[model samples]
Target chain A: MSKEELRMHWEDSFDHKYVKLKKWLIDGMTNGQFRFGDRLPSENMLCRKFDLSRQTVRRALDELEKEGAIKKVRGSGTFVNRVFAQPQRTSSVGILSTVLYEYIFPTIMFGAENILTSAGYGIEFGITYNKVENEANFLKRMLEINPMGLIIEGSKTNLPAMNVDLFREIQRKGIPVVFIHNQYAELSDIPCIIMDDVGSAFALTELLIQNGHKKIAGIFKFDDVQGKYRYAGYGKALRAHKIPIVDEHVIWFDSYEWLGKEMNWVFEEIAECTAIVCYNDQVCIKVLAEMKRRGLSVPTDISVVSIDDTNLIANLEVGITSAVHPKEIIGEVAAKTLIKMIEDNTVGNKSYSKVMPVEIVVRQSIANRKKMEKHHE
Target chain B: MSKEELRMHWEDSFDHKYVKLKKWLIDGMTNGQFRFGDRLPSENMLCRKFDLSRQTVRRALDELEKEGAIKKVRGSGTFVNRVFAQPQRTSSVGILSTVLYEYIFPTIMFGAENILTSAGYGIEFGITYNKVENEANFLKRMLEINPMGLIIEGSKTNLPAMNVDLFREIQRKGIPVVFIHNQYAELSDIPCIIMDDVGSAFALTELLIQNGHKKIAGIFKFDDVQGKYRYAGYGKALRAHKIPIVDEHVIWFDSYEWLGKEMNWVFEEIAECTAIVCYNDQVCIKVLAEMKRRGLSVPTDISVVSIDDTNLIANLEVGITSAVHPKEIIGEVAAKTLIKMIEDNTVGNKSYSKVMPVEIVVRQSIANRKKMEKHHE
Candidate 1:
């Protein structure tokens, strides 16, 4: 580059609209290099030196403040991030989940954190909570921040196309995005991090069948491919055993529910059903809690099984038995695959699918009905 | 306030970097608005009419995408957010938890979602994960796209201060920030959301005494006031009953188990105590898991009481008894106060410590040691 161009580049770098003044000071200090706890010049001095508005200068300083590059006391002045080094930011990955209100998201997030942190990725999350706009807003925001890779729990539908625009944006920007649960049907070529919902559901249903539970129910929500896959597995298990699919035993809600009224209706309808398998741990908790209220002890008078084991059940007096969702593995795979996608720019390719298996944790929660013929409680 | 200024704002609204050319088309639609499902004009028209580079013109459409405002198919152009009530935003409040990996941060965030969503605020999050620099970066990025408010879980001793400089910048720019856990000690006037650690700790200890467990062990992180409060409370609880504080039973690990191998030595020292009360849930989880490996059962052989009850314990098989932190209330208060700070531009006020009471959940984990002669399976 010419000397003039070099000087121009230097000026442009110094004149960065977002962090102009801070950049200049830090660059100037680069030779002297500000160490931890180095006091920054007062706001007035910075404003005067940069010939920039106080607000513009504040932006750079604020960035510095958040970085702990500097500390600011109300009456006192700004100082530097005392413990900072040349930051090694690679170990951080972003996890974008559906919602924050749902227990499943946080529980699944817990698992993801365990695997990612153990494998050396710091976990950060953006909560979509099933909203397309928020998801898109977060995505646009995410593009600007850019983590190592991203794990996105795909919506059942194609994000109604709008909320999904961010998915395309994620693709266009060459950021890796691994879809969770239902793959982005529209973007079928992208790899997804998933669970063995089909296998886990089949195994749970088989367990119930082996335990002599002929009258059975599969609890789920409508419109989700994951839930649908579980239902299909349930069918596969029942069909193999020569049992007809009972329409009455197929119970579903528009959303996840274990409310007393909802459970009561199910119980009243399927009075003779001996066992129930649920989509996730939440439904299982509700089912058990409702069953207990009705004086129906688990595994004795009635047996209950669920997909998705969570820390929630581990805290219960009677431990819940069921295969847990592979949240961590799925997160890791999703994170890794997304990073790969970002590197390869594989947004338009055939979507990838991942199905992790679940493990049955047996302690209590499920018992054979035949053992309770002459017993109570 | 002036007519010329109003005109400038009107033009600026349309000309700002974020403004999309499609907005102009949408505005020009019949009845001065476009209906849902109405197909937008082609990009050529946008480029020609707006006199913008295709890259610049595409941003307006991009906003709609992330927001799920419009749907786009490959070979097909963009459509609107299908659940589109004519471009309505989903109601959500975003939380910026410092570190997503920590157990306490999740617990607090869980509470924030509970209160905010119920109050008609949608939940979202930006994670600094306790890195002051990362925190600053996220703050700048978040500012670029404003959320309703932010609930922040801050870092502990010697960790980077969150964009304190940026937070002031945020205040200058009229954004609300609720600092939770570690609030700026020097900036007492800054709005913060936190629990009454001392009160709750004292209460937990008192509860143990009331439950008839006197020979107790206290565990906490050495730094941070929360630990100090728990220690003080333990001392207070002991003093209330005229029992001497057992110096040997107090265990503190200051530096990320900077104690590492010596963690065992500390654990061994505390094992002799009959009843153990921990500062928070993570410490409880670690301590309890370690104890079980050593063949000790909870509540029966050694009653363990945990502070900060999360859903993990309530649904746990062992039923860890714990004190509940008012996450939603704290988050709500912090947010409201931050908003106030943002609006008022006030400086130099001490944090109004809102000491909420902690409820002790009587779970099976806290056992009556006198009744257990055998180990729990």
Candidate 2:
């Protein structure tokens, strides 16, 4: 079976003989005909083996690649598709989020990716940009990559038809998936890593109270899992302390992805509260930047504290007081869990949850409320 | 061609004939037999027509997939591979870097990704993490994803053997890969994007001199390309002003990545200079953080400026005056050039290079040299 012989067969055959070869290739992968990083013989080898031409052989391999069948490593050669190659180790989970370079997502995702990668499993990532279609598309690609488990940053509920389809496909394919930060109650079977929002909010709020700040302010993002939880915590903390939660004191914005349009609005709201708690580190960073741009100073005119602990925030020019979540811990657990499910195919219908302990790091962002009457918008 | 017939064909010899059928499927895609986004007939359709079983029919179709042949949408019928099926206008370009999330990588990478994505071309990304293995691995993988071009963030001069082999393979395959941020000046005829370090450094130093900073302090990373030009610039600027740069004010931190282990030697030099211009933003940020950790304030106690215009510096609590490079434009031009090479396969034998522009953003980090002396350690 050589290239010349194969070209002749293609001309002679009105039969669909190619389909059988596809199964053979897949069976070869499942049956260990190829190892994870092993590149198969060139199309020439396959052509000679099967009396086929180079083009015919390549066509067969190409489709497997498209169907998440194999990974064609250019220059190195084509290898067995790892997305479906090995039995997934709990450490080799995949993550798909709407954004990768955000304040919170990285904090959470890096934790998971690092833990998993350290445990000898690789983690591949996809970004969705908060769009349902993109999420669905990313989901499809992730599945084709054949990760043992998935950790989606946002809730799977209220998504578009395509997103739902992707989730359904993952389930149908028997792949385990996890939701993180926030989730839908109805999706209880899906494991998740969530923050203890109400508790954290209450704790920080009490800190403000103990600092003698009655006119405290809360600034956060809206329409997100973490944002809602932080807000709820703010409210619960206020109610428990017998302090009124004034809507005016709560200024809201979305994720840092689109933070600028609301800067002016935040300026108008700054005059209302003695102290401010930002939703995450990025918002706090932006607030500080904008305020400086407008010739305003922090702690002197307005005291501020933020949530989210990045590697460098503690040592920043302004020591930011923050509630830090153990992102790496959560990431490791998710990877481990997904790997377990992939290996045994028995991470049964249970919604497991892990909440890493969070504590506030007191920095320079907060101070006792001052009697300032010269507040200008 | 139908399911019933394909099942019958499974019992036949699994040989050359299957290869032929696979090519026809591909030929169909190339010949406009199946339009872009159009799904081929079902497995069952092939089964009946060829008198092959579901298994055998799949084998023939499988071969059509492996070589970038086609895309098989789950639940939907398999579609022709976009390489031949879809037009190049819908194609995407990719960006690959080592440790993309670190220091200035993300800021520069993001700027590039944003610009490319906004231009109606999809951008795919990969992080090589300064590892030759990872770099080589990603280089192959990036090519497999079929990017029109690539923007490599670091110097290829440092790549390991395997990576070098693969990179050469990329050139052999006629795909254009452009180097950015770091220069490949030694390698004749390598395509690259670079900053005017000699000119910019001279400018940066002139700023320090103009601000009355004769006893200037410098902490730098001693990399050949940027470090060489920058150091030269500083010397040239000093010569122009009839000022001598005291060697004591110039301290070379071999790397910030080494956790400042190499910086112990620099402690003695900080107090000598009134103003310190750093090699890059990462060094500047780290030094700033270290200084704060040591209870020193920037600009007030010791003025600082650095290279690289990343948002990381912008997000810093105190703004540092620094040179900003045109990162996104670099990415765009690199990608466009690579795409051209990939398409025309007409890369010249000589290396090509493009020098990107830089801007000096004056922030609060730099102050008059005489004023900086008051706060010098």
Compare the candidates by TM-score and give the number of the best one: 2
User: Stretches of candidate 2 above 4 Å error?
Assistant: A1-92, A101-110, A118-120, A155-162, A255-257, A293-295, A347-351, A370-377, B1-377
lDDT of 2 by residue, A144-248 (tens): 766667777663231102244457666644567877676643455677776676567667877777666777777755435566567667766665676755545
User: What's the lDDT of the predicted structure labeled candidate 2?
Assistant: 0.63
Off by over 4 Å in 1: A1-93, A100-124, A143-148, A156-162, A256-261, A315-318, A342-352, A369-377, B1-377
Q: What does candidate 2 score on TM? A: 0.37
What would the per-residue lDDT of candidate 1 be over residues A4-32, giving only the tens digit for each residue?
A: 66445646764565455667656644433
Candidate 2, position A80, lDDT = 64
Clashes of each: 55, 64
